[model samples]
Target: MKKLVSMALALSLCLAMFAGCGGTPSSSSTVSSGPSSSSEDTSTSGFENKELNIAIFEGGYGPEYWEEIVDRFEETYGVTVNMQISPTIGDIIRPQIVAGNVPDFISMNDNDTTGLISSMIRENALLDITDVFEGPGLEDTSPLKEQVLEGVLNTAKCSPYSDGKVYLAPFNASPMGLVYNKTLFEENGWELPETWDEFFALGDKAKEKGIALFTYAGIHPGYMESLLWPAIASAAGIDTTTDISNYVEGSFSSPEVMEVLANIQKIAADGYLMEGTVALNHTQSQTDMMMNKALFIPNGNWMEGEMKDAPRADGFEFGMTTAPSLNAGDQRYVMTSVEQFSIPAGAKNPELAKEFLRFLYTEESVKLFAEKAGGIYALKNATEWSKDYVTEGVYSMNDVYNMGDSMVFGFAALPEGSKVTPRDEVFQSVADVMNGAMTPEQWAEKVEASFTEVSNMAK
Candidate 1:
């Protein structure tokens, strides 16, 4: 998948450099000044006889749930939903969008390395569906805005432009942390660590037993940032993390940020990471943990489904938890990874697309999505919707509230052609520190320099 993304990104970059890929958003791209409270039924929305096109990203999950929802929608509204499913949805459909052909709805993720959806945002090609939330939900008469889980709308990823208008609807809630073998911990009589001191002590014990404390897949910043950033937020405080996320100048130079970096450097210097881990791809690192070559690997909730059939040690059972905190009584933050859905500005049936989105929050539709995909959407009480259907490792997060609430990587709007400064890139420094290529002090200096460059770009 990374290779495919690389190839597609290369092609897109070539096109962008030579063919002027900037999109002139049609006049229809204007959003309503505010949300509408109209009490209109789905069938009476003048889209009953139209076609609503949907393009969904098929990543480690089937579209069976979407198919079921589409069937019900067609039976109710007399509309045909042309559903196009592909693992390479970003690579294929993004080009069509660039050519002025658009789907009414798209579920591609902007966080993917390909940056397909980000490119569209830069081109102003996505519709603003703020009115969808103001409308009624599928099963109740209450407004959809009132049905969403709290703090979800607070996610900066929902509004990339930072203008307070929602261009994307957050769909799936995938929390990330250090995934480990529950059976292994039980057998070793090791308790899950709640603080940095205890966590490092466990690392010492694991080292004596020929098991490394932690390892991560490759040197990708996105992968490691999920684990480290939340831990940093918990240790340094969310305000500092927020400043860094929002591109506040010199935020990374804060003492709190430095403290988190020093602790991570200690882990690297102590030889707690598995040998050759920096070179391993995501699946290979996961395989190492599965085979008991390492004690824990940082990853998202999707780990179980991603490695369901892989070879593992006897009695292996997956488990996950938020990053261990700086102190025993500190507030721990669980880093969430959410997938998003959106409508194109020039979609043929924008109203119908929004109707389908609102229908997703319905009780029956939410249940069906969980049962089929083992994924939970962001509707109210969505996490508790179906326990039996939630994925294995994901189920452990049901107890996340016992520690603290969940938060995702901070979102900041970056200008076009801006490169992600090396200082903000966490994984590379992790790999470098672990491999003895850079000292912690040197790493700090590099980060300070990088952020300064980013500050210049913003100006």
Candidate 2:
């Protein structure tokens, strides 16, 4: 298996581009569509008669960004964009997809509960949009691939199959790890730990103050992947982590990985985790953490915007850090959550959908996204380009890249007719482990059994 390299170099360049920038811009001041002249000459020749049907999962980022971009795409191409966006978009579109009436483009994620993307991967039902990246970007003459963050497109998140063709396009690049209240840390003079030993030591200090060291969305154990995958890379190596993703035999039970698992088990066994954590849903866990019941929670940068209306401790502000390393001065890794976009294999207007996909990478569209969504796109230098529009917290989250490498986690796509999912094997049993109903060794053996089944299917 090939080792996935770090995106540190690309992020270093992004940092250099915004060297002296400071302060976040107000919404009103950051609402320009960018220079219209930059996009005036682009031709939409054959796409004039075509209409696009798009399905978007309206989550924390909201639908305003999508609506704005769709309008711009329609205006530029002289065509109609019929967009269906909802919080339950998957449930709404699942029937349509089964009836062979799939939308031209979709903006849901693989980890979504509907299992739509996972199903599509199993059935090989997604369109091959590789040319969209290989072709020129909407804003410039450079290939669109060059505009993406380094090491982002090659992952299973974009290319589900181990084969080299890309089906899903990268939407946003978000850093995921432990989220904490920055103000609390400052008030207590608590230092962020670099090594696991320091991490446990800090947990002891936090516990003295009646704060548990960690918690997570127990009902949605998948959130733990943000911490687990990166910790594995930091402790074992990227190669070993990649092997786990590829379902290689013994990868999960390897001595190094077992040690990482044991440490995670120690969190539960030693009472470092918050009490009743196993019963709380995502919102409940996050809300409690914000109220200062816990020192840190494994989560993504979106936690702030997602819980904006929820009551929190006074002066609470979001802060993110990479997973702790095994030894001092060892390399750390921050798992990046890259949402996806794709065109279905069955579509009325594949060409028009492809055009709309490319249109999203334009400077105007990128700026609108930042202004309306308060998030950065996956394109290179996007954080720098939209720095004025995003919040200070989000900007600071991007700085985590400087402390560690960027990692994207996705198991290779399962073969058709396979009965088990990687999530079912790996994460679903986390509650059992935390409850002491199953030991870490038992967890590893069970996961290896599932991996064996999947490996046989591939063979």
Candidate 3:
């Protein structure tokens, strides 16, 4: 978990450096027209199969980027890419995976509700693609590992076993937090709150203007993790947050964490949460927030792209901020939402799949992704490199990294045959809390009990 601890500090440094460098890309600057396959000589040669099978999840970012990249990969290597891209890609691939007809590469995440990635983790069914990362980059002399943001590859998301080997490759690294309309705040002459006291005070002020302070995707309560993890880190400190991720016995029930939980409860109890928030799904909640029905929504940077075509209030513009701090000058934390890519343990063309993964980190692919999907890749300087391609709002979202510490939130992998998932134990109860069916103390106690179960399983 030292790697996990270092990730926050590493991101802080990356952001600081980015902030200090003020120069913009020149007008003549352009992404490479195509992927440079010269440096990929060793990895791409002599493919047993001239085809690479890929399954991608079409989430907030659409399939256009993947389609374009897959086409480029095919053209560069003279191969056919059989790609299955869908919002419910997990469902389409699950049966194939169960029958041992797994794809060469999968672009889904561990948190997908289909439990595909999590099941693979529990069964050790993912390919140990550590070499893919340790090998040289496709377009540069540096190792692929050196090209990515620091401390990201070592997390449980990538190295589920905590053994310094990466099974999952990093995809998009997005800053997750409170998303609001910058224009609305400016029009109202409202300042972003820096601490919880000011947060509640703002809630009161907004209430007078007929605006609720917060709203989240109620049906998918896990979305609240954008707010929850950062708030916990701000309240209890990063080490305590890591302790919670590791499922230490008292981490969830500790006094500081309980205070964070209580404040979350206060959002509901004090009527700071919007009406009908308990029934809204992600799109609905986001739409309402954009329409000014609620002042803020717990979400990530991709939200802007996802809702690009959706209706909004006059002068609507996306803005984001870290969770309110515990004290005026206390360091805040911005939880990072990292999607993943992995090869199944049983793949027809592991070598080719590895090559494709390497290609994805290339400057050409990174810029293409930013231009087509309006999202940044997980690689170092990706935002800065693609700033001209993405929208101004998406570019400004990177400022969250500069404003606060960046963190990735995931509990330690559960042992095989374990009956509980710590994430579900925590987030699933959020809807109940919002509805007054569960108290914050009860929420903490329930989560602690599940953690105890996981701890005992290790014994």
lDDT of 1 by residue, 1-459 (tens): 001223345356334321111111112222222222332255666776688878777665455666666777776677788776555666667667778778889887535666777666666778987777766676676877677766655556677777877788878777778788889999999998888889889999898889999888865546776667788888888887777767676677677677777777777787877888888878789988998888878777667766766799999888877787887888888877778888988999888888888777766666666666667777766877655567555677445546666786645656666676442464567778878888767776776676666678878
Name the better of 2 and 3 by lDDT. Answer: 3
TM-score of each: 0.84, 0.92, 0.91
Instruction: Score residue 141 of candidate 1 by CA lDDT.
Output: 69
Give me the displacement of residue 258 in model 2, in angstroms: 0.8
Best-performing candidate as measured by lDDT: 3
Collision count for each candidate, in order: 0, 0, 0
RMSD of 3: 9.2
For model 1, the stretches where C-alpha displacement exceeds 4 angstroms are 1-41, 391-393, 416-424, 427-429, 441-454
Clashing pairs in 3: none
lDDT computed for candidate 2 = 0.81
* TM-score result, candidate 2: 0.92
Q: Candidate 3: deviation at residue 167, Å? A: 0.8
What is the C-alpha lDDT profile of model 3 across 79-156, one tens digit per residue?
778776666667667877887778899998536987778888888989999887787886777788888888888888
Candidate 2 residue lDDT tens string, 120-194: 888999999999889897667798988999988899899888678899999988899889899999999999988
State in Å the error of residue 373, model 1.
1.1
